[model samples]
Target: MNTDSTRRWLALGALAVAMLTIGLDVTVLTVALPTLAVDLHANTAALQWFSSAYTLALAAMMLPAGALGDRYGRKKFLLAALLLFGVASLACAFATSAGQLVAARVVLGIAAAAMMPLSMAVLPSLFPEPAARQRALTIWITSTAIGLPLGPIVGGWLLRNFWWGSVFLINVPMVIIGALAVLALVPESRSAQRFRVDVAGVVLSALGMLGLTYGFIRFGEYGWGNGLAWVAVAAGVLLLGAFVLWQRRTAHPLVDLGLFQSTGFRWGTALSIVVNFAMFGMFFTVPQYFQAVLGVDALGSGLRLLPLIGGLIIGSRVVDKALPKLGTRAMLAIGFALLAGALALGALTTVDSGYGYTALWTTVLGAGMGLAMPTAMGLAMGELTAERSGSGSALIQALRQAGGTIGVAVLGTVLATQYRSELGTLNRDPISDGVNAGVSVAHQLGDSAMLHQVQTAFVGGMAAMLWVCAALCAAAAVLAAVLIRAPRAAVGEQQERLDDAPHVGQGADASESTHVS
Candidate 1:
C-alpha cells in the first residue's frame, strides 16, 4: 500500500478500461451500421469502409507504432494516443457523411494502435514479479473479453433509446477518465538502447498488410480469378517479403526479427490469426441465423449469443488455471479439439435445430475461443523483453486484427461461393432465397418452405466452412504442441528471475519480505 504500488494498480485499471473501450468500439459499431447507412445516405461500399477503414488502419499501423513508442517514450505516446482517441471519438459521433466517418475512424485507428500494444508493454513494467504480471495480464485480457459480450447489447440499447452517434459518444467519458488516470498513475518505461524508428520497415509492412487485407476483401467480392486480385495478392506477398528482409538488416528494426526464433511467439501468433478468422466469421454468421432464420430481433440475437459469452469466460478461466498444471501444449491442444469438435457437430444443425440442442456445442466452441486467445496473447507478451516489447506486442495484436480482416475476406469468399452454388440449384431469386447452402443457411427466409431449403443448403456450407475452421484450429494445436514452451519451465524461470529483482518498485517492505521468505 505504498505510492508506487497504488499507482501501478490504478494504471493497470486505466489500461483495462482502455482495452474495454477499444474492443467495445469494434462491435458497437456493427449493431449501428444499418442506422448509420440510412442517416448518411451511404451505399454498400461506404458501409464496408465504415468498418474496414478502422480495421485496415489498425492492422497497418500497429507495428510501426510500437517502434515509434520505443524511439520516443511509451508513456508519452500512450497519453497522446488516449487524448487523440477521445477527440476522434467525438469527431466520429458527429460525422455527417460516410466519408467523414471513415476519416475519423482512421484517426481513431492510429490512436488505438498506440494504446493496445503499449498496454501490454506497460504491464511488465508495472508488475515485474511473474505471478503479479500473470494476474495483471489476466485482468487486462478479461476486460477485453467482457467487451465482446457487452458491446452489441449496449449499442442496441443505445440505438433503441438514442441516436446512432450515441454509440461513439459513449466513448467520450471513458477516454477522459482513462487519459487522466494514465497521466496520474503510469510510470514511464523504455529500452536500454536509444532505438531509432525503422522508417523503411514501417512503410513496407504497412503497405503489405494493407494490400493483403484489401486483396482478400476484393477477392471475396470478385473471385480469385480476377486479375486485380492476383496482382494485389502478389504485391502483398512481395512487400511482406521485402519487409521481413528489411527487418533482418535494419539496426533498429520496426520489429525484432529474432523473436520469431521463439517457437512460442511464432505459433502463438499463428493461432491468434486463425482463431480470429473463425471467431469473427462466427460472430457475423450467427446473428444472421438468429434474425433471418429464427425470426428474432436484434435483442434476441444478442441474448441467444449469451451462452457463447458465458461459456467463453468459463473455458478461458479454466485454461488460465490449468496452464500451470497442463502446460501450454496441453491447453492449446484441448482448446483446439473442442472448437473442431463443436464445429463438426454444428454441421448437424438445421433450421429446426432448437437453441437447447445447438447451445452446448456452440458453448464448447466459445470455451475453446476463450481458452485460446488470452493464453496466446499472454504468452506472446511473456516472450518479449523491454527492448522488443513495443514492436513485439504490436505484432501480436496486429496479427489478430489482421486475422479478422483476413477472415472477413476469406470467409466472405467462401460464403459467396457456396451461396451461389446453392442458389443455382434452386428455383428462387436472390431476395426470396432462404438461408441455404451450408451450416450457415438456416436463416434469412420470411418464406417457410424457402427458409427450410435455405437452412438445409446453408447448413451444408456452414459445415464445410466449419470443417476449415476445424482443420485450422487442429493444425494450430499441433503447432503449439511442437512450438510453445512448456508452462512448468516457463513459470519456474520467470519466478527465479523475478525473485532476484525488486517487484517493480513495490514497497521496500515487499522486497525485504521476498528476500527473507
Candidate 2:
C-alpha cells in the first residue's frame, strides 16, 4: 500500500460527502418547491427563480471559482466554500420573505459554484494512478447521485412530517462534516503557473449567461414575440460574443481558449451540454408531472421517479465497467440513443400512463444519461493538466449547467407553447378569471388527469426536444470519433493510468486501464 495514495482516498471520501450536500441541495429543494410556493405565497416566477437562480449563479461563477481555486489552493477554496455554503443554507432556513429567500439562494448558489468544481479538481492530486483515480471518482460520482432521487423522497418525508425549511437544515451537518474532514485530510494543490484572473472574461460570461437564462424564462411566459425576451436573447448573444473576443486578446484568459481548439475537448464539452439539456429538462418537468398530473404528493412523485433513479444507478455502475472497453465515443452514442428513444416513447405518455410506463421510459432515458454523461466528462477532464483541472472542470460544469438552464428554457417553452395552444383551442378564459385552470384542475379532477394534459403537451414538446437531444448526442458521437485522439501508448500510457468518472439532480470524470466502450 502506497502511503500517498491511501491518504488521497481518505481525503476524497470526506470531500465527496461534503460535496454531496450541495449536489443534493439542487434536487432536494426541487421537490420542496411546491411546498415553499404555497407556504410563502410566492408566485410562479418566484418558484422558477427558487430553482433557476441557484443554477444561474452557479453557472456564472464556476469558471472564475475554478480559476481562483488553481491560483490559490483547491483544498483551501474547498474549505471556504463549505463554510459559506453551510452559512447560506442556515440563512435560507430562516428566510421569511420570497425576496429574502431568493437572495439567500443566490448566495447559496455562489457557494455551490465553488464546491462543485473544486471537489473534482482536487482528485487528480490525490491518486496519481488511473486505477485508484477512477475508483475515487466513482465514489464521488456515486455520492452525488445518491442524493438526487432521495431528495424528493427525503424532502417530501421531511416536508410532510416537519417544515419545508427542514431540507436546508439537513445541509448544515453535511457542511460541518465536510469542512472538518477536508481540514484533517485534504492537502492543498494549485497551478504553479502565474496566470492573471480574467475579470473581463468573468463579467462577460456572467452577463451572457444571465441574459440568455432571463430571456428564455421571460419567453416562456411572454411568448417568442415578446420584446423583452428578444432583448434578453440579443443582449446575451452580443455579450457572450464580446467575452469570447476579449479572451483571445487577453494575456491571461479566464479559460484557455486553446482547450476548445482540441477537437476532443470541444466535442466532450458539447457532449456535456447535450446530456444536461436532457437530464435537467427532466428536472424541470418531472416534479410537476408527478405532482400536478400523477395526483401524487411530493414524496409520491419522488418515489415514482424511482425508475429513472434506479436506472441511473445501474447505468453508472455499468458504464464504469464498460468505459475501458467501449471507449467514450461508443458509450456516449449508446447512452444518447437509449435516452432519445425514451423521449420518443414519452410522446405516447397519457394522464393515466401509470407509473409502470413512466418508470420504463424514465429508466431508459436515465440509463443513457448515466452512460454518456461521465464518459464525455472524463475526456474533458483528461484533456487538462492538474493545475488546469480546477478551471477546466469548472468550465465543463458551468457550460453544462448553462446547457441545463437552456434546456429548461427551451423545453419549458415548448410545454407552455403547447399548453397555451391547447387552451386557445378550448376557447377558455379560465386564466383571465384570475384562476389557474392548471391549479383548479389539480383540485377538482385530481392532479393526475389534469396533469396528463400538461404532461402530454410536455411530452409532445419533449418528444421533438428528445430528437434534438439525440442529434446532439449523435453529433457528439461523431465528434468524438473524428476528433478524440486515443492516448498513444508512448505518450499517454502513464496518463491513461488515470483517465476515467457522474450526477446531481440539482446539478451536477476519465480512465485508461479500461477503454470507455
What's the TM-score of each model vs. the native? 0.89, 0.86
Tell me the tens digit of each residue's lDDT in model 2 across 136-187: 6666766776577678888888888889889999999989988888888887
- Any runs in candidate 2 off by more than 4 Å, and if so which? 1-3, 38-45, 422-424, 427-436, 442-464, 467-471, 474-517
- Every candidate's lDDT: 0.75, 0.72
The per-residue C-alpha lDDT of model 2 at residue 274 equals 79
Clashes of each: 21, 22
Residue lDDT tens for model 1, 109-190: 8899899988887887788776578768877877786687578888888999999899999988998889999898887766
Stretches of candidate 1 exceeding 4 Å from the true structure? 1-6, 427-447, 482-485, 495-517
Q: By TM-score, who's the top model here?
A: 1
What lDDT is reached at residue 479 by model 1? 72
| Poorest 10 consecutive residues by lDDT, candidate 1 | 508-517
Candidate 2: Cα lDDT at 155: 84
